[model samples]
Structure formats: C-alpha cells, structure tokens
Target: MSSLKHSHLYSYHAANSRLASFAGYDMPLWYKGISNEHMAVRTAAGLFDVSHMGRFSIKGRDANSFIDHMIPTNLVKVADGGAAYSVLCDDNAGIMDDILVYRFSSDDFIIVVNAANIDKDYGWFKQHLDGYQATMIDETQSIALLALQGPKAKAIIQSLTAEDVGNIKRFTHRRVALSGVDALISRTGYTGEDGFEIFVPDCHVSRPLQAEKVWSQILSDFATWGVLPCGLGARDTLRLEAGLCLYGQDIDGSTNPFEANLAWLVHMDKGDFVGRKALMELKDHETRKRIGISMEVGGIPRHGCEVLVKSEYVGRVTSGSFSPLLRKGIAMGYVAERYTGEGTAVEVSIRGKEWPATVKNPPFYDPKLYGWKRVA
Candidate 1:
C-alpha cells in the first residue's frame, strides 16, 4: 500500500475518526457519521481540518502585476487584506484551477489552491515568470489550516481570540495572535456559512506539536458550545448544498470559466491575462452551462448520472448529494444552455429510472437562514 501524508491533526482524527485517503493524505471521512456532523454545522458550529489544501506565498516588487497577469480576476483592484476568487487558465482558456488570492499588501499575497493541483499550479506559475520579478514559495507543508463554520461559528471563534474576530468581514483577513501563537485568520470558508479559516504555522522545529495544541485548545473550549469536529464527508455535503463547485468534478482542465458559471471571475476589461483573448472570443459561443437540479421525486442524484431534457440526454451530473438541511437531493451539473433557466424542468437518470427535477439556482439552503447573511 502506498504511504499517505498526515496532517498535524492526524493523531486526533485517528483516535476518533474513520480514516480514508484523499488527495494523497490520510484524512478523516467522518467521526460521528456524515448526517450528524452535517447537522451540527447547519445548526451550530463545526471545526474542519483542511490542512490538505495548498498555500503559496508570493512576494516581490511586481507581485501584484504578476498575479494580475496570471489569473482571470482583477487582483490589483482588490484592497489590502481582501481576497478574490479567481480561475487560473491555460492559453486555450481551459481552467487550470480555481483559487483564492489573498492580498496582504501591494507586494505580498497568498494563493490558496486545491491540494491535488499544487504541483501543476506551481509549475504553471513558474513557466510564466519570464519577465516578472516575483518570488513564489510553496507554504503548504508549513501551514495547518482549520475551518470553523456554521451559524454559531462567529461566537465560537470570538471566544478563543482577543483579536475581535466578529469584526472581520467576508473575504477579508487579519494576522493575530491566536492562543498566544501567531496565526492568520480569514473570514472565508467553503461550507457557505459565517466562518473563519485559521492558518497556523506548523513547520517549525516544534512541528505538529504546536498545531495539536491549537486544535485541542479549540475543541476543549468549544465542546460545550456544540462545536463538533467535522470530516470530509460533512464538508462535501455542506458545499453541495451551497452549490459550490468541487475541483476535478464540477470543473477540470477541459472546462472553462464561462462553461462553469464562473464568468464573473473573468475580467476582460481589466486588460490582458493568460486566457483573456480566447475567453473573450468564445464567451458568447458557450453551448453548455452549469446549473443546479433539485430532485422533485424520491431518487437521489449522484455524479455521472445522466441529465435529460424532453426525454433526451443532455449532460451528466458533476456533484450531487442529499442535503441534510433541505432533506432533498440536490445536484450541480452542466446542461444544454437552453435548459439552464431557473424552474426549467429536467430529469435525472438514477439507477436506470428517470426522476423528475427542476433547474434552480443553487444553494438548496437559504443563505439568510443558515449562512453568513445571518449576523449574530
């Protein structure tokens, strides 16, 4: 068997989790079952060990200019301490990866990417560094990330730090001393909740010990507050309910921003970027579009299930799950552009049976009721 990399919190997960392999890492798939963990985050708060994601630190006099030239978003316009979601694409306009760019200053920034695309994304950045004077350093191994999410996330996190975490707005971040250890806290998450992603330095000589301390401290402090330690199983379900796209599934090298309903990330008016020219030319000619399908029948939709319109196959599901909050099957997939309108009727072929569905704007759960929109 191939050896798997372990995160700083591996020991904690091993003692209480059902371990599984994910992106070369030994990760926890679930602890108290997916449904229980899912509900915890929906109603209370949950902590996620997301250290498997890649973190890169970019610094140089030309960092801002270099980033603007690399991704499809206008990173230069993002204020300091703000983050922007963007797509990295090849010259042919195919998405390389969907990433979050955090701007600390004009010459300093951080790029967070999917774990599986780390090496490829780093190489892509280096290959385009001919004239740019930016320094890129992979910090994935040096950082341990924790995500505290859900309706009660703010209160749980606020109790641990004296940095006024409640004041941090979405897409913004700050560097503060968390539990006497320096950490980067960002108001961002994948679970569609009011949450914070904490970045703790874990590569020092003390190594995982420091990370474990922080993890244990959080659990001890928030256990009575209904904060459960979540695993990837719950994470997937929550993101699916929020209609968030997963890399390698909902999007891949064969898909572009326009086709994935992410055209908002592409800034054509901001000047030339890697795939700007090709994207601009083909933006209007896209035939398929990403849409949400909510099952109206009793069947559960799964990835690779056939999507049909008018009894004819149109596309396939990329991600799907039964939402714990909504108690219904929700899925996201690419379909013929004509069938992408909200309320359009469609069918999903599951287990050789056709189940009626509707094309609705995703977020099977209402944001105001469960997400960041609910303040306090």
Candidate 2:
C-alpha cells in the first residue's frame, strides 16, 4: 500500500488522536472525543491543524483578471488583504471545487482549496495561464496552517502577538508575528465562530520547530480555557451545525451554486466568467433548492437518506449529524423547489423507516447565541 502524506503537526495528532485515513492522509478523527471538542469550540476554544488543505499562490501582472475569469465571485470587489469564499466551475457551470480567494494585490493572490482536489485545481488554474503574465506556485507542502476558533480565540492569539488581532476584522488578514513566528493571520474559519487561521511557512530547514512551538505553547498556556487540539470529526459536526457544505457530499460536478443555496456568490453584472452563460441560463430555473432539516425523535439524518413528501420522492440529504450544541439531529439537503419552504413537513428515510422532519433554513442553531454573531 502507498503511504499517506503527513502534515507538519502529524506527530502531535498521532500522539493524542483517534486516527483514521481521509483523503489519502492519516488524520485524526477525534481527540478526547468528538462531542467534547465540538462543545469546546462552541463554548471555549479549539485549535485545528489544517495544513493538509491546498494553498496556491498565483501572482503576476494579470493575476486579477486571470483569477476573476475562473470563479463566480467578483474579484474586483475583494480588496487587497481581503478574502472571498467562491467556487471554481467548468464551462457547464458545474462546481470544480469551493475555494477561498485571498487577494494580496492586483498581481498577487493566494487560493485555499480542498485538499482532495489539490492536483485537479492546480491543473485547472495552470491551463488558463498560457496567455496571462502570471505564475502559480503550489505552496501546500511548504506551509503549515492552524485554525484557532472560538470566542476566546482572539484573546489567546492576542496574548501571543503585539498587534491587536481584534482590529483585523472578519474576512481580512494581515502580516503578523505570533509566538515570534511570522505568518499571515486571517480572521476566517470553517466553524461558525469568531476565529483566526494562521498560515506560516514551516519548511523544515528554516522554520523547523515554529509550527509545533506555537501549537504546544498555546495549549500549555490556555489549558484552563478548555483549549484542546481538535480532530476532523469535531470539524465536520461544527461545520454542519453552522450550515457549511462539504465538497464531495453537498456539492459536485452535478450540483450548481443556485441549487446548492450559494447564489449570492455569483455576480452576473461583473462581466464574463467561466460558467456565466450556462449559469445565467440555469438561474432561477433550478428545480431543486438546498434546505436545512431538523429531524424528529426517531432518527438522525445522514448523507444519501432520501427525502420524501407525502411518501413521494423529493430530494436527498447531503450532510447530517446529531448536533452537540443544538442537541438535535440536524441536516442540510436538496429538495424539490415546491417542498423547500420553511416549515414544510418531510420525511427522511433512514434504515427503511421514515423519520418525521421539518424544512428550515440553516444554521440549525440560533445566530445570536452561537456562531460569528455570538456576543464577543
């Protein structure tokens, strides 16, 4: 068997986590427990090692227009030091992968993409670079990324830096030194919480001990705040509770942004893009809509569970789980447009039994008490 790739912090994960293989990497499913890690992030803080995700730096004279041509989000609207969540699509408007575009300048940008699609996404961008005076560098192997998420995340990060992390604002980043290590710090995260993602170069020779030093230092200092190293299991449930989509499950080449409840990312008036024409034709004509579902007492909704209305087929669950914060079975799925309205009754077929459910808009928790909107 072929060996899986390891992150800079792999040794730490292996020492403390319940290990499993995901996306051809040996990953930690949970440390301590999924529920505890989930709750810690919701109430306190949780640090996640996300170096496996792909980070590509595309920079040169035509970087702006070069990137704007590929995705739906308006690159013009995103200023330097800002990030926009968007998707890469093919000519037919099928999503290649959901990504984050970080514009450092008109001719410089870094894109964070799904780990499993690193090679595919890199090729997608490189093929379009023939005419543009730009270059794309795959930096995934040379960097270590850490996400410190929670209401307490800012405070912990602030103590390590001389700069005011609170002033960084959401969706923006800046060059900062944390624990004496230089890195690009962004106020973004997958968990629906006020957090920061740190990207530092850990090239073994120059920054050999930096990533682990910052990680170990924080857990040591903030142990009383319940800050723990979280694994992928907690990450998944936290994202689902916050109503975020998982690439292969909630979306694929067959799913368009509109049907996936991501129409806001598309900018039709921003001139042309890769999938604009086809997306325009499919706009408002999509037969199904992505919806959130809350299950009854009987079962927990899971991926591929068929959704029904009046015992007839409608859609299928894309992602689901028993929420640790909400204490209920929550899910996100696609359903027929007619049956996608809030409060619409439906059934989720799990193990041959139809469990009662109600259609609702995400997230499955109250925004005022949880997520990035929670009191900070």
Candidate 3:
C-alpha cells in the first residue's frame, strides 16, 4: 500500500501514539491505552484530533434549497448557528454517510462528513447541483479539528475564551478566539458527552506548526485538568458504549436510517428530498432493526460475529467492544424486527462459542450517567 496521508497533528501523534492507517490517514490508534483514554473522557476530559474528517463550505443564493433536497432532515428547522445531524442517501434510501450540517445562515453552511467518504460525498453533491446555484467548496485540508470532550470540557474551554461556552447550548456554534487562534466552536460530539468540537482555519498555510501550536496550548493550559490526549481506539469504544453508530461498521451503503434506528433524522413531512420516496416505502417494511446487546458472559464480541436466536442465525454484529465503563462486552447490530425489543434474549458467537446476551434499546450507557445529559 502507498504511504498514508498525515494529519496536521502527525508529529504529536507520532511521538505519543501507536499509529495505524485509517481512511487514507496515518492516525493514532492509542496513546497511553484505549481503556485509559476511554475512562478519561468518561470522567474528566479528553482531546481528540479529528482533523481527518471532511469539512466543506456551501454558500450561494440557493444553498438552503439545495441542501434541503440533499438530506432527509428539515434544514429550515435549524436556526442560524445551530447544527443538525443528518445522513446523505442514495436514490434507494441506502445511507451514503451520516453528516453534521452547521447552519451559518440560509445561504451559508458548513458540512462535516466522515473522512473516507469525502470524495464520494463531494461527487454526490456536485452531481446533484445541476440546477442549484450553490457553490460547494472542499475545506478539508484548510482546517484542523479538535474535540474536547467529557464533563470538564466546558470548564477547560471556557477558561481559554471570553465567550460564554456555557451558553453555547447543544448543537449550536459560535466563532470565537481560542488562546490566540480564531476558531469555530460547536457544542457537539460523538461520545454522547457535553463537549466542543473546535475548528481552526488556516491550518494548510503553516502545515503542522499551526495545528501543533494550538494543540500544545490547549494541553498545556489544561495540564492539571486531567485532560488526556485520546486516539481512535478509545473513540470507538466510547462511541460504542454511547450506542452511536460508526459509519462503515454500524451504518453504511446498504443500511438506511430507519433500519439503523435513526429514523428520527428523517423529516418525511418536509416534502421532497433525495431518497424520500424510497425511505417512505421502506418505513413500514423494515425487516431488521438495529439494537444494542450486552453480554451476560465474559467475552468480547467483534464485528461480523453471528447473532443467534434460539440457535438460528438471526443477524450479525456490526460493532462491538469490551466497554470499559460497563465492565462487559457491549455491541450494536441489526437483528430481525421480532428480536429488537428490550429484554429480548439472544446469543452472540464469540470465537465459535455462544455467549448469552440480551437486546436493549441504545444507548447501552444511561444518558444521566454519561453523555450530554450528564453535563447538562
């Protein structure tokens, strides 16, 4: 394989992490350790270098109209400076990628997408822009993204800026100065925690130096706040415990929002959007549903493990891990609709042996114990 592209934080990760190739980027798999980083984000704060995710700016007279027809969610419902989580879909309602749309105005917005799908998503956007007057600019390489997450996230971030981060509210954003860098701070995260995702622009100019400077400043400022530098390994386990879907693992080209238990993102009533017709048709005919499962026996479940119902193969695990917070194996997978109810019994094949498991509605961790609710 060819050498992987490196993020602006490559130097820092190289010095501190066990590196691995992911989505064409050389990313950190772990720093101190997965379990250690996971708990740090759960109890205190953790900083994640998520600059690899694709970032785009869409602006034009017809931006809102074009965006409304592209995703399932109602863009009109999102006020200025607010964010909405939605998915891009093919004509058949199959998910292309889940994305977060940040509305700066009716004619201006920013989209953050999974790194692996950047080119594909950019193509999709261009293909459908034939009649729209919007201009989509790929800003992926021009910015560095960092996620400051956990219970102490707000406190740490607030100390750096005069802006009241406490008033940001969830799913909202503001342009502010962090230390000395101008940044767009959003009250959003994937770890189901009260946190902020900071976007620092002009990263491509100075290369790694600009990114490294900001990253170092944050860590140094909060050195005593128990903020650990996290990696993708902990990110996976944390998101799993929160029951959040991973792009390729939990939801992908073959999965639709309905089957993935993300029907809430679809605004059926908001007339006319790509995949609306197909999604409407599949709404009542979903054969399988995504559900959470927790192991009763001690064993870690992995992706592609068979899920059994009464000794019959019912489904396969899409994402699983040994949840550090729960002290047991937890997973999310698609199973027959009949077996999706909470308290349903099932068995997961772990290394050719069946382990007792039970189905439950996600998130596996209680919102009150962790996530946005915990900090709110």
Error of 1 at 172 (Å): 0.4
Prediction 1 TM-score vs. true: 0.97
Error of 2 at 111 (Å): 0.4
Candidate 3 lDDT for residue 102: 94
- lDDT tens digits, residue span 172-268, model 1: 9998887777888899999988788988865532277766776788788878877789999999999998889899999998899999999889888
Ten-residue segment with the worst summed lDDT in candidate 2? Answer: 201-210
Highest-lDDT candidate: 3
lDDT, model 2, position 83:
90
Task: Give candidate 3 regions above 4 Å deviation.
Answer: none
Could you tell me every candidate's TM-score relative to the true structure?
0.97, 0.98, 0.98
Candidate 2 local lDDT, residue 267 = 93
Model 1 segments more than 4 A misplaced: 202-206
Better of 2 and 3 by lDDT: 3
Backbone clash pairs for candidate 1 read none
> What tens digits encode model 3's per-residue C-alpha lDDT throughout 330-356?
999999999998999999999989999
Would you list the C-alpha lDDT of every candidate in the order shown? 0.88, 0.90, 0.91
RMSD of 1: 1.4
Model with the higher lDDT, candidate 1 or 3: 3
lDDT per residue, candidate 2, 309-337, as tens digits? 98999999999899988788889999999
**Superposition TM-score, candidate 3 onto the true structure:** 0.98
